[model samples]
Target: MKTLTYVSTKSVNDLTWPTTYDNTNIYSSALSVLTDFQTAGPRVIESNTRADELVQLMKKEHVRMKIVVDTHNHFVGVISLEDLSEDVFIKQVAEGYKRSELMVADLMRPKETLLALSYTSLKNSDIESLLYSQRENTLQHLLVIDEGTKTIRGLISSNDIVRQLRLDVDVAFSSFEHTYHSAILGQKFQSRSLKVA
Candidate 1:
């Protein structure tokens, strides 16, 4: 058997800690969910990423939404698979916008127009409150913003909520406007059934 002794260097400076954490134990709660960027990290794409490339990326990643960031990696907007569809591209071409020239920035919904919920607010809320807010806003995806940092903290999806609650939720909406409408209406029907029983 051989034994070795380890010694620490006398002058170790400028060492840095890892910024990443293991996310295995994260879960959903009445306070807030774990799917937020603070926990799961944001799925981001560059603003200059081509629309065609975006479609391929989404398919490869098995993701429907991606956060759009600038060259400096600052959050700019968000893009969805729905926004990168062949139909959308075809329509844009019909309107004289060159398909080859389109970029993620052009296809993303500007952050200002997106619906966001405060992380602090979510901390004090329950699943029912989340459902109510989703219904009221007709939102399939809700961005959680940290009030102190004023930065995106995470995302909450209607389907995720349904899965967590073990409810059968069909979120197949025809358009952006219909996304949450169906969920809200479904919740209403569930409420009515509970009342009748």
Candidate 2:
């Protein structure tokens, strides 16, 4: 009996330090994407907005998360759809309370929350794990803040990740494959009339 010639190559995989993306670079500007809220971030509630209004904003943004702010725009608390599931809001609406009458303060989680800064370096694995640990399986949105003021400076979403990866993949497999090592993605942070970081 004769055996066909065969060849196999052995390979080893090694762990690498996660690549970081500065949230300051990836986050959407406070003045741009935050069309829903005129102030800065999705924080301020008109102090007159109803629960229905909040729900509508959440649905429209497709974020399902919100940060409540006082009239001074001071960060107050956070509101999440989970807080007002059918169990609570339904009962209140049935009792004839308008969404406007329900202040965001009344329905928001405590001020202590998982806040982050715009300049912070975001590691993909760490962020992903953080969200999972909070029981948030897939993070559609994450807020980037100003470390000095704890104020929101911008926002980030999963789509951004996909966009970046696609860009990188394209460059890696292109004609410049031999020079791909020099194609690093570096981010410079800036905002209107100021250095964001």
Candidate 3:
């Protein structure tokens, strides 16, 4: 056995906080904003969870989105705080379903209808170009796929990008469609105006 020496804590005044890439502008690399699952685990929820319960849990945990999984933990879909909003539940109630009977799978964006960006492509791009390319997509959260491993690598959130870059754009909570039209399209238009000026 080797002898080990213990250091004194007398001089330690502060703890080092972990830091991510500083995304101070739109030109920052797209990878900088990715919530890589390999590093930080994805927030997930079960498909059979109650919608109202999920809303309360999300609010309490301060989580805005969660990857939905089946009982076997297989990826099934994704659900955002917006997915469990009052209007959505009300719509289901109109369709003859009881409010308390709604499940997360009912409102989640199913995997079949989702699209993802390849990790390789994202690594070579910047935030501005990425957003410009996705201007036509009605997405608030974008998944990143690892083509080589054939697995989900991570995700990017429009809200995170907007916050990190401090963009003067509003991502309305009314609906994902409205957010796409107003925020993404607005960015595209803003860029065009800047070029003209």
Measured by lDDT, the strongest candidate is 3
Error of 1 at 72 (Å): 0.4
Candidate 1 per-residue C-alpha lDDT over 62-100 given as tens digits, one digit per residue, 9 for 90 to 100: 788888999999988998887888999999899999998
Candidate 1 similarity to native, TM-score: 0.73
Better of 2 and 3 by TM-score: 3
Candidate 2, residues 6-63, lDDT tens digits: the string is: 6554564665774543452223332222222223346445434566677778767765
Query: What's the lDDT of the predicted structure labeled candidate 1?
Result: 0.71
RMSD in Å for all candidates: 9.0, 19.9, 4.1
Point out the higher-scoring one by TM-score: 1 or 2.
1
Candidate 2: pairs in clash: 50-99, 50-100, 51-99
- Which stretch of 10 consecutive residues in model 1 shows the poorest summed lDDT? 20-29
Estimated TM-score for each candidate: 0.73, 0.43, 0.80
lDDT scores of the candidates, listed in order = 0.71, 0.48, 0.82
Q: Ranking under lDDT, best-scoring first? A: 3, 1, 2
